[model samples]
Target: MTAQHPSDVDLFAPPRRSGPRPTTTGREIPHDQLDQFSPPRIRAALIGHATALPGVFTGPSQVSEPASLALRLHDPRGRWEAFLYPSPDEFGHIHRTGFMHLTVPRPIIAPLIEAGWIEPHPITLRPQWPDTIVMLYAPRDEDELALATAIMDASWQQATES
Candidate 1:
């Protein structure tokens, strides 16, 4: 793929997602995040972690349905891609299921997805919802939380440090 369409290169190539893939309704607006819900404490911790990131703020999603918690970046690095968003670029958002929606870099995507850490957002095939936007499944336990944190760090590094 050309650099101009860097995101198009090997976008879905893989080792493949490890283990069982989680269930999703495959609908963008009502993107299903109901199963595998994180415990309340864990959800709170995730929100705290997501909110504390530099250049980010938490608020109602401008585009998502009501009550959706979204994190918008003040000045996005745009390393994920300068693709248009329904609103300003979002860094990520935590869902009721403890899942996260993030703008992850393309190169690391295969490893992350193949590792069973994340999956493509339900509507990734749509013109606006490119594959760069991925869904990070909820961290189910402390061990998974640790993994989740590392994944967030990696996602952020790709977003800000690339």
Candidate 2:
């Protein structure tokens, strides 16, 4: 066998043109354009329903608990249970260079406190995703529901924009 020089080896080559290109534009046709990108619509069904009070705004989407952590909201009288399902972006935030913390507007939180939806509970770490919060509310506490709705709506809105 003959010894081969390292520089003689072809370590890298241009990517092979495997698929057909447009005759006119010379651009590859995206597969999604032909098939129409569609997936089964799966929705989160609310197991325990909570209502926001009148005059509170409701945007689309339900607030579900993140799988990593369970939230139990407490008041002077008792405790309320909630589950959490965090979004992918939340994971992205926690993995960043520094610890990221999200502050819920006081305007939103104060009303829920006064209405007995939540108390002065310690801010729960958002599981593996540090950008979210969770809660369980009593019936017709509109403010809390609206806040939850707003969060979900904002997430969906951001998702669509990109």
Candidate 3:
């Protein structure tokens, strides 16, 4: 038997062409018009809404992930109202997944988890927290977008209702 180097293994096969490739119609299509509700687009919309709130500030996240962002809301009493960012995994690693983290009242966490709008933070495995629960959500579908919006609204209320 001969030893095989890792590079010698064929991990993927090139595409096999069965016929002439299909061509698009002459009508021009803009890039952004395709998948207008893609994850990045949804993220941008969320950031826009969050920043429009009173005393809310937007900044690059200190956690150092590629293309990560954060939002901070401060109340008049010199206390943090809310902190929002992308949720990280249990090992404290973040991917550019559409999941998010919102620090809000413990009360708001449970129902959202139960209703299937979000999942309990993957790190802690519980809806309540010493560290606020990270929420897992996807704004891919209409229902999901509605649920995500509701969760954001609830978080905003929890932050400002003090």
Candidate 4:
């Protein structure tokens, strides 16, 4: 009997795509199209606020999948504060998903999950950050963005203060 390869199994797992994941649709959206996938205005505001924070650097996520264009927030001490990226579904559709991923504290994760604001990361996909991260659902308005931002801020505070 021939040995089964890893790729030949796990049909239930999320499909992995090559190249940079698109912010919306299968293609990369322009910088101005940030709002299309989620709340456009809120997305811009959140990004602006994060970038303006002291010691926070906004750039592509270093720890994410290759060619991912996630907006990574780094603390003053050079630690990762959070990551904001389009949440892809199992089929790999990046556009119109309206969800986002954030890395935050374990203590606050439960409430977010319970409130339907976020969901726990899949252990199989992110074993490294299982208990410490949550996927922020589509923040379609300012209120949602506010909550997401607050969590991100807390993540920064936790990373820096510890």
Model 4 agreement with the true structure over 79-125: per-residue lDDT tens digits: 33333222221101112334555556666666655555555555324
Worst window of 10 by summed lDDT in candidate 4: 86-95
Off by over 4 Å in 1: 1-19, 79-84
Clash pairs of candidate 3?
Answer: none
Across residues 46-151, which tens digit of lDDT does each residue of candidate 1 receive? 7877777787777877656556688776776655353225555566677777887776777777787777778777677877565777778787665556556555
Ranking by TM-score: 1, 4, 3, 2
Best by TM-score: 1
lDDT value, residue 18 of candidate 3: 22
What TM value does model 3 have?
0.53
If the candidates were sorted by their lDDT against the true structure, best first, what order would they fall in?
1, 4, 3, 2
In order, the Cα lDDT scores of the candidates are 0.65, 0.23, 0.41, 0.44
Please write out the lDDT profile of model 3 over residues 16-80, one tens digit for every residue. 21232222121211101121232766655555656666665555554334344554454522223
Task: State every prediction's TM-score relative to the real structure.
Answer: 0.75, 0.24, 0.53, 0.56
Off by over 4 Å in 2: 1-43, 46-88, 91-103, 123-147, 151-162
Better of 3 and 4 by TM-score: 4
Q: Please count the clashing residue pairs in each candidate, in the order shown.
A: 0, 9, 0, 2
Q: How displaced is residue 44 in candidate 3, in Å?
A: 2.5
- Which is the winner by lDDT between candidate 1 and candidate 2? 1
